[model samples]
Target chain A: MNAVVLSPVDLAIAAALIVLLAALSLRLRLGVERQLLVSAARTTVQLLLIALVLKVLFEHAHLHWVALMAAVMILAAGREVSARQKHRLAGWWGYGIGTASMFLSSFTVTVLALLAVIGNDPWYAPQYAIPLLGMVLGNTMNGIALGLDRLTLDAVQRRAVIEARLALGERWQQAIAESRHEAMRVGLIPIINAMAAAGIVSLPGMMTGQILAGAPPLEAAKYQILVMFLIAGGTGLGTLVAVSLAARRLFDERHRLRPERVGSRP
Target chain B: MPVLELDALATRHVGPLDLRIDAGECVCLQGPSGSGKSLLLRALADLDPHAGEVRLDGVACSAMPAPQWRRRVVLVAAESQWWHARVGAHFPPGFDPAQLSAVDLPPAALDWEVVRCSTGERQRLALLRALALQPAALLLDEPTGNLDAGSCAAVEALIAAYRHAHAAAVLWVSHDARQAARVAQRCLTLHDGRFMAGVPAAEAPA
Candidate 1:
């Protein structure tokens, strides 16, 4: 199969479709015309910049550059996770936990896949390592965010129940066991659903992109499966780390629930 | 000997005073709503921030781990929280069914879902749950507030029996003066952040 490259004029023609969608939203008084235009502009600029960076990265192929890029990605993902939280750990704790969890889960999983599973010629090859890391990190960050948010919220809302258990001579782990389970479950749900619906409900983005670039359908599906498994493992590990850390953070050393540590929220 | 002692206990809103309850003694604490009555109990239970020291039978609260201290000096809040779907799940393993009978609950009540339990049943069961731990001291906050007169009498009797058997110290918070008079060996009123000898004239029931 041969892939077709779109020139600038072809790209302009594709961009026209977004303008048409925005105009239709305006006509229907849907009130998202401005948002649609801003999002479209941002998507265009961000993707182009990322494309240029990736091109440069692939050409250079230095270990230090790869490490720097990975760090930047993890940091941005951590910030995204922290910003989505309603009740979060105070000060730098939320950001620190998110970044650390992603680094441990996604980075480790990606390295293992590159070196051991795929056994690529150069383990940190930007062509494979960067894209795979991006997918795993994205999913892991979401999982950590969801788990942390759920854990914090439950810690605050269910203080009475947790304390009742503590009063009953149960350890801190036993007291918040239910909440911990729930938070991890919430974190894993998205990935679980994606896994279940992968080929049938939707052709996943990575697989579709590969097939669009003229990779064989079967080859693309195999790669997609590997990516999915890596994502699932990364998410599970990240969520476990996040919820465990969060549950511990919600209490003091003596097993008292300190909702103040998460700071006050209405 | 005093089973529980608070040395100059001061929270943000109340205290900075000292008190003690001897073994087998039930001391009633009466105060208006939001006068820091619950806060005092919470502080005693090591659930709230406070200054000064709390000790159980010469063992400082700070000395023991929190879970151990909490087990010995338990606080039963007015609105008890039931986490498990089934009533029995909340209790510890090998908990005696006979304990439930002491609180006027049937043995089969253990199998009942917590959501199906009546407010009175929950109140009684919560008390039983606390007592089952064999705590040395109890910080009870309106333990029978939702109970009828007969249930209230039953709870008081059960508490009395337990206190006598174990020589446990109890800090019972109640708004009913007559109930306090009947249950407490001595009553202390929280007035303007201070513990007075008896119920204030305004708060004292006729």
Candidate 2:
């Protein structure tokens, strides 16, 4: 066998695409460039680290370690949200949206992909389980971040309007309805745009990689559809949880919206 | 029954403080910036974390859900945020953009982006929103700071109307002696993060 193999051209094209994205972010002066840069760097380091550690886990098949890794991912993402919110509020929201939503949504996608899609083994196979779970959970984590950020910030800024709604007999949920819309709009827009522009605008990275590695067009398309659907599922569920939980922090026992922080007096 | 009560309130900036107001009364908190006048208002609203008890009509405010408490007891800051595209978009329900007419705004104001509103406009709109809610108590943090005479008159008239119609208890925070005299029924001065009785206001000068 001559070891008929895929060429490096596909890999080179992918690398170039990433480089262009980095340049575009800088050119646009998108303030979130830090988020993008850090996100990209983390992905690289995480993949490399996972590859080394996963080899051992794959060989030995340690269920405990797999569970532990999942927990670490959830906790780390939760803490990141905590750091941003920063307070007792930072605490409630971090765990509320970050931990509960992240873990619940991630676990849901993981189990579904495991049982129906990949056909889970007795001890979860690291190759299939970790990466697939990661894809769904990672998307959920990001949605939580986006949703919580918008919700918290809106609460701080639009307090007067919120109180007005309350005086008009609106409850926490009703008053927060507008803020929730803001959060959802910000959180879901990026993914919605990607979904809309996919295929026609450009072949997604996952599908393109599969095609480059000699998978047939139909096979790559199936993976693309699968990943996109899972992303939607993860984001939808995760956002709902994070927003609902974050809103809880705004209310007192009599069901009034509590202020996380007020302006400092002079 | 009192509309507002602060019993033995202990906060980050000050010690156990006590304040109370009856229905339809307006209490003014005035001091230099950073004297904790605003902090006291925030504490009463449970906006600032604190060790204190705040009661409204015999119910503990700190124990109530925050959004709900805010609904009934609102804070109108000097600069309140308007997040919508324009002046009219802030209303959650279909507020008949015509309501802006009552506030010196045209129906077309709805189409204008929020970036267009002047500081006075934001302050005015925030007050209008609070009045719209018909809150049981108002925690106003300088509602008139940015307004011109006309805008200020408009707000003053509305305050008088809300006081009459709703009997809402108002806690006004201001740095201006003139504005305090214009709006409040009674005034308390804040110094070193605590409330003291200010000089009696000139007879609500015409």
Candidate 3:
């Protein structure tokens, strides 16, 4: 019961389907034909590049190589988080807060899972560590980005209400409390929906992949459950940290509502 | 000692000026639009970034926590803002119902939804909201800008009562020269970012 290997021609068949979809988009005058084709190309290039990197990484499996890879992954995720924002915190804060929170939450959660739950030898084994960290970081990145985007945009749009509260002598924390909670809720919505719909509404991608690769159904299901919990914990903690830090940055020590600190996309 | 003192207070467009208002005194500030009238009040309330010293009873603004300082020196902005659904939610517990009637609002106004209130009503409620804190100094940015003749008189009378009862120092910003003459102990006009002895309300253009 070994899994059948996919040749280049087999993948080409999948690529042909994408070309067909792009043709349909073009015929419909849906302006997305170019974006669809380009994104499909990017997916092929990016995944193939990562596959090569993973091959080298698996053969070496040294702690240093794994740490370097993790650093690169987190940095890229941080940039994505910043780019997703409509009104990002100005200067370094635009990039730093999301990056720092993702690093803290995803790294801690992945390491804990490796050391205590899975108990992999050397704990930083690239086989276990890389995939787990990638999964957690990816989810955490989305949460932090959503949380931060919501927070900064809300702070700007609700500037008058916030300052009014501030004028009435409410502390900065109290003034921005509702916006913070709202941002956190928005960030967590995706992961919550995914968890709720998993295995029933749709088979989760990781579980399907594992089962397709010939792992027993029950073993793949157990791994999928663990991954889901890890993602949930990582995302929740990351969003909480990112939103809190971003909220604090929206005001100064004098508790003034500094909407200017959150700059709009130029 | 003066209840509110500004020394070299400056924001981007206003001040680096000096002024004082003793307890129970009202100073009317007048200027054309964009002359930084609101900025001055915001600076005094520590709601905007500004330079120089502001003192309440000789206590420097920087010496106290911002919220504490703001609690003692409240600002009522020109346009009122309400975050709660019910008007009562914005008020503190044990707020005097008499204050509502003093502003000509029914006691039941508290239970009304904020969205249901008119611009003038919200303005009056905003003033009451600030007064409920019983601040020692008040920064009123066109507190009656939205009110009719009757509502404006009611607001002025209510402010006068509050000031006398609490010995609060008041800096009232207004465009109406007659209203300034009616409510202010001294009037000053901000021109080119500095205060000048105001022209007589009658002589001054409307």
Candidate 3 residue A24 Cα shift, in angstroms, is 2.3
- Candidate whose DockQ is highest: 3
Pull out the clashing pairs in model 3: B9-B16
Report how far residue B45 has shifted in candidate 3, in Å. 0.6
Query: Which residue pairs in model 1 clash with each other?
Result: none
Candidate 1, B61-153: lDDT as tens digits: 889988898889989999999987999987777888877777788898889999999999999999988887889999999999999988888
Tens digits of lDDT, candidate 2, B45-134: 666567878888889975677666766777776667664576665665655666666667677766767787787777777777766666
lDDT of 3 by residue, B9-76 (tens): 99987989899889999989998888788889999999889999999999999999999999999999
Model 3, runs deviating above 4 Å: B199-206
On DockQ, the stronger of 1 and 2 is: 1
Q: List runs of model 2 lying over 4 Å from the truth.
A: A1-100, A118-127, A141-179, A193-215, A246-266, B1-3, B62-72, B85-118, B121-125, B150-154, B161-168, B174-185, B197-199, B202-206
> What are the C-alpha RMSDs, in order, of all predicted structures?
2.1, 6.9, 1.4
**Reference A-B contact fraction recovered by candidate 3:** 0.89
In model 2 chain A, the worst 10-residue window by lDDT is A257-266
Identify the runs in model 1 with alpha carbons over 4 angstroms from their true place. A264-266, B197-206
A82-183, model 1: which lDDT tens digit per residue?
998999999888888888889999998999999999997788999898999999999998899999999998998998888778877778899999899999
Per residue, candidate 2 scores C-alpha lDDT tens digits across A161-222 of 77555544466677789889888777777678878999999898878877877788898899
